[model samples]
Target chain A: MEKKLKIVGFLCNWCSYAGADLAGVSRFQYPADIRVIRVPCSGRVNPLFILKCFQEGADGVLVSGCHPGDCHYQEGNYYTRRRMMMLKDLFCFFGIDKRRFHISWVSASEGKKWADVVTAVVEDVGAALRGSEKQ
Target chain B: MASTENRSEKNTRRESIEQFLYRLLKEGKVDAVLVPKRHPGGNIVSPVLISEPSQIKGTDPLAPVQTVNAASIVKELVKEPVDKKIAAVLRPCEVRATIELIKLKQLSDESLLIIGYDCPGVYNVKEYMHGIENREDKEAFTEEHIHDFLSGDGDLVRESCRFCTYFTADSADVDIAWIGVEPPGIIVAARSEKGRRMTGGMNTGDKDAPTVRKETIGKIEARREKRQKSGIDNLLDLIQPCIRCYNCREVCPLCYCKECLLEPEKMGYTSERYLSRAERKKQIRMPVDTLLYHLTRINHMGYSCVSCGICEQACPMDIPLGTILHVFSKKIQSLFDYVPGRSRDDELPLTTFREEELSEVEDV
Candidate 1:
């Protein structure tokens, strides 16, 4: 059997965590690769956490928060958007495969959308890992 | 006007600067002036805060040695409210770093006057200490350095300084310029209203900044840019020898965090956790998280980095951290169309965001 790829997911408590919970309750099946960690808001996710995940042997990382204006704390995800954007650029500059890192806006009501997002992210991460292994 | 023969005998430029600093003290223009002076028994030149006019005798404002960034000292000097005004003599990079600190709220500029100068770069600290070990006339050594630098031979300077484009103090309040002037002539150019007021009675030379100065700076800028492009490749390989001494962070002027997250205790690594990590990875680097430290530092302060190259100087492993950080930060700053220390009014890139900008960062 092949070893499982470890993907760390940071989900904002207000929107993304609720969305993931809704996906489970509604039986919307998605990849089981991600290990979810709840955060107060996307803004609370320091870029250090993402880098730390990579340092600790995580194969991929995902950060999900509420839509820009729909942030529970009001303007939390906006800061996350900017921070993550810079982090993404930094990752690329350091020769990290950008596809292994994903950012999304998931709403509490969007259970099906969350499931689809996870499936796509898992596929991308798997492909990226395989591509790097070949090289 | 003295003859060329007389100029050759006396170090006129150093003497004139010493005279200017003495006047600043005697005339009470500033309560004290912060300038570099040679330590009593060594070739080491460090920043000294001199209040007495007589103490300005051995101070060399144009010394080809940078012991510390000096912005960190400036930060410490004015961290709280002070009653006295101080004039800080600094190089172009030091002034830029000071401006960034002012924006970051780490340093207050209320009681500080930044006097910057045209810098013909300094040698690396180790190289400088070694080069001047047996020299008796330290002043002659500096004069020879300036002569070589003026003649466009930058081979003896630090690697970072050789490729540094900001060799003049354009961002400073008062700029003491000598790069393009005839020998022994220095021009004091006041850049701001505060500068103008502070230098009110001082007689700047009758001559305007020569056109040749601009041309010289342009040529240097072009050459350095080309050098910068070719020198910044293979960053990972360059940092391979880093011993995780944290010297780079200790000496960085911009790293003002009270408690750093990179500390060993903060990392929370137990012996069991280390074994587990090793087991999981099949093998692990002994002093782990070195790459993480560098990357995290880049992410945190890359936007505010002034490319002073002090970090490279402080590294025990001789990592070309200065070039790596400089090149990386240049790219990161360009993303937001921002330049650190360019202006006091501009908001830090990480602190502010546009509601309508960076739409591509989000997927789905």
Candidate 2:
């Protein structure tokens, strides 16, 4: 039997976490595979944290933060944006599928958008797993 | 390229630079001079810290051999404040690394004088040692290497050196400008107040930077810029030969962790954990996590990597770690428009960010 895909979501407390709560309250449907880990800010999310998740058998990882100019700490999301962009390239350079790592911006009011982003990420990760199986 | 007539003229100027160091010692401008000197046995050269003018006799700052990045040595020498100043003659990379170390609080730059010079490049240590062992006049050999480099011959140069664009020590307190200058002569320019004070009354005939020097440096940089575009497309395949020798970590000037997490004590697993890990990975390769180690290093130090190429030299596997790091760091640095070792005033990218910058990386 194929392993059930496990996704880890790193949601910022000020926005993304609240956005996730809104999604749940509104009964918006997204994959149940994602296990949420609330961090103080997206800037607190080290590249090692994501890599450790992969090492510990996470099939996919989603990092969602406050929108670009809306970071609660002013520029925390900007740092995350730069760091994650480089990390994504680093993963590809190491032969890891880019689909396995995703970054998005979701605010407390954007519950519907959050659900859609999760659905898109899970589908991409599923496709990646199938492609690796073929290989 | 220096003409034959220019070479002879520059030889005299080279001697004057050496004499200038001797005068610095006599004048007490510095407590000591740190520069590479030929070993008494001949054919071998290493950095020697000399306090006396006599000991400065064979000081050759232009030797195309780098035993280690001199900045680390500078770090060791001046980790604490000193009563007297020390003049360190360094290559551009060494000077740059020193600046970074200062920012990291690893080195106190107060009582140090950095005299940086134009570097043509260096050969791989093993290759340099082999090439010089049979030669009677090692100085002549080094001279020939520099001559060949200036004349468009780099067959003996290391791959990393060939790809380097920052050959001149623009960030150093005092700079020796050789580009676009006629042979046997170098123009020394002071970039700081301390530099101006030290070189003052030394009679080392200073001049304004030549107009042609910028264009010469620009041309070399443009050539290297083309090669910088080639990144390691298959990093995993390239690192497959890693035997877990920790040599790269040992020699990296920027890898300054007192307790490295990659050490055997930290990374080594118990018998049960090893067996379980192997089971999980489905017959994992022995000495597992080699790829993981490399990736972790890239993530940790990729931002500050100055492309000194010393780490690549330290690798037993000849893994081209330097070029790989340079490629990765170039990408990361560009994301924030951050250039490591550019200046002490420039904040580290990872430690600081602008509110308006890097918005393109934000997901919609």
Candidate 3:
């Protein structure tokens, strides 16, 4: 049996956080491996903050915010997306499993998609973990 | 050995540089000239822009030490719609800083000329002067006296300049290489088109600065050898005295941070990290990455290093910051065949990234 991965989900209150709440209200189910931390905005997540989560025992970290242009603080999510893209690119350039970090946009109406993305991210993290242990 | 020029000639530094610029100002060769002078209070000095030749009387070209990079200010000075060219008087470092800023598009070269001088390193104004001794003893030093006063065989120099190399200009448009200690005139090395063109008129002095250049070279090499032996430990010692006072960064001519990303506000540094004595080591927040900031800036801008020692001159701890930056800059330049100020056409390493680089080095 494979060990369960501990994934951390940082959701923006304005969009993804509410969307996750809606997922629960809509009875959409996903793996309980994810622990949600509510942030006021996605732009509040600094790369160092994400790295800190990984260092503090989070096997995976997912940042879900409003779509690029729909950021509550104008270009907040856009900045997050750009900086995250650099981090993701850098991680992949190194040999780190890029699947460990996922960034997405899910509005309040996207409860089904929210469950689907979270389920997919956890599944990928579990796959990477098993692959790492085999070595 | 030939030009026996000597004396505390009645001519102030104002007269020498301005006398040269007077003709240019009259000939419309330059639109403006930027230099520094002892302010009205007779103590603090800063770089100022001089437009009229008549107003050039207050200029001091041979200030015993300089604390600012006048080159960045020159870039700022030239932003106007100039009808003609502008000439800037830069210590070797300031000139280099100006060129780096120019490459970054922070400055324009459309109508700009540089007059770079051999830098006789300056005091960290607050530390060596105000912090250690009397304020009115300003008369105690002179540039002619530097090679003697800072011989280091007898006494420590103002720690910063003593450790710095590039005390002379290798990259100025008009290099005002000082000939010798006595007369204190310069051997003008012209490496640019504008420099050669403008000098077509003046009865300029010959190149005697390099005769002293060998001695300067010897002194600098010895310092480098000693620094290489002791730099890491020397750097480790500075963390104690460094009060996180951004004086080094603030006074750095090149540390032009519109919003310094390293600021606690910007980096989101918190106070609780230092709660436990043992925890300090785990998260040493003491001016976090102070060394890295200096190193990165050097890596970022050193190749174009004008050899101006202003960064060292600015550190309040009297950290020989410029020496470290120059060391890295020198090493990287040798590694990559890059020399700052050799040609404006050459691309800076940070600006250009090759896809195929390090393929040969991968096996090593």
Candidate 4:
């Protein structure tokens, strides 16, 4: 049996988490690679969380938040977007593959979009893992 | 805008500064003066707190070596309110760090006098010590170093100083200008009411700042910008030798967290967990998470990093930690148009958010 790639998804409660739930309810198909952890808001996701996931052997990390101006706490997603973007740049500078860590905005109403995003993320992460194995 | 012109025509630069400080103490303007001084052995120079005017004899505030950022010392001294005011003579970096500390509530400005000067930067302690080992008068080291640096002999200075643009204490209450001025003279300009009050009795003459100062500052900034651009690419390579000793965190003036999350207990690692992690990774570094530690600090202190570079001095591995930090911070701070230690009124970037800002950072 081959080792399974572990993808950690941090979903904001107001939008992305609900979007994930809606995907399940609507019977949308997506990869089971991602293990979702629902946070109060994307702003609550510290940069340390992504680093910790990587350190604990996560092959990929995805942070999904409410769209700008649609945050449950008014501006949490905006802060998250700024912070995560900077963190992504930092990871790139650290020589980590940019594909391993990702951030996106998915509203609660977009269950189909959520499935598509997850499918794309899982594929990218799986590709990265395969590339590393060959190396 | 009270600027102090050179009062004495014959005194050397060091003598004039000493005289100015001596008078401040003698006239009872400040209860104590915190300045660097040569030890009785005449080898090392360190910060000293002198209450009496006569005790200021060995004071050499312009030494070309900094043992530690005096802002941390100021934090300790001013943690409690003092009955009498104390004056601190600090470098540009120290002044900026003190300002950041003041905003952090770690140090109070009340009953405290901040006197800062134009800095030519300092040599690392070991380098300075080695350079001055055969010298007869260690007191002349600062003047000699300045002359050499201005003459383009910069190998003696620390790497951080070579690329430092903030060579003037723009944030200080009182700033002493000397970079482009004539020798044996310094112009003191008071930026705050407290500074004005302290210098009211000095009766020093006023002179217009020569335009050469601006040109000199611009040249240094251009050089630094060039150096920084080239050095940023090797940041990961520079930090690869990190032993995870956490010396950088300990030496940082802005890392004031009493309970840092990087601690082993906070990281939640069991004894067996290391073995398991090593098994999973095939080979785990003995002291793990060096990159995480650096990133966490950069995130925590992004807004407060004064770029003092004391962390680089403390690193045993000789990593140019300051350059790495400054590169990241300059980018993040520009995102918010924020400069740490610019002013007490300038809100920290992490604490405040504007509705229509940072759209470029978002994925829409």
Which candidate gets the maximum DockQ versus the true structure?
A: 2
Across B1-364, the per-residue lDDT of candidate 1 in tens digits comes to: 1233344576667777788889888999899999999889869898999999899999986778898999989999999879898999998888988999998999778888999888878888888898788988777677777776766645768877888888888788888888778767788878777888887878585323588887877887887777774325466677789888889998898999999999978765899999998999999876887888898889878899988889988998988888889878887888899878777778898888887888788764
- For residues B116-187, could you state the per-residue lDDT of candidate 4 as single tens digits? 888878888898889888987564666777776554537768777887878788777777777777877788
Task: For model 2, report DockQ.
Answer: 0.56
Q: Which stretches of candidate 1 lie over 4 Å from their true place?
A: A1-4, B1-11, B203-209, B230-236
Query: lDDT for every model?
Result: 0.85, 0.81, 0.63, 0.80
Model 1 lDDT vs. the true structure? 0.85
- What CA RMSD would you report for each candidate? 2.8, 2.8, 9.9, 4.1
Q: What share of the true interface contacts does each candidate keep?
A: 0.55, 0.56, 0.00, 0.18
Candidate 1 local Cα displacement, residue B165, angstroms: 1.1
Error of 1 at B273 (Å): 1.4
Q: Under CAPRI classification, how is model 1 graded? A: medium
Can you list each candidate's DockQ? 0.55, 0.56, 0.04, 0.39
The TM-score of predicted model 3 comes to 0.61
Deviation in Å, model 1, residue B1 alpha carbon: 25
lDDT: the better of candidates 2 and 3 = 2
Better of 1 and 3 by TM-score: 1
Q: Per-residue CA lDDT of candidate 3, range A76-130, in tens?
A: 7765664465455334322457778888889878899899988899898888787
lDDT of 3 at A54: 61
Q: What is the lDDT, from 0 to 100, of the residue A30 in candidate 1?
A: 91
Q: What value does the lDDT take at residue B345 in candidate 4?
A: 82
lDDT of model 2 at residue B147? 74
Considering only N, C-alpha and C atoms within 3 Å, which residue pairs clash in candidate 4?
Answer: none
Better of 1 and 2 by TM-score: 1
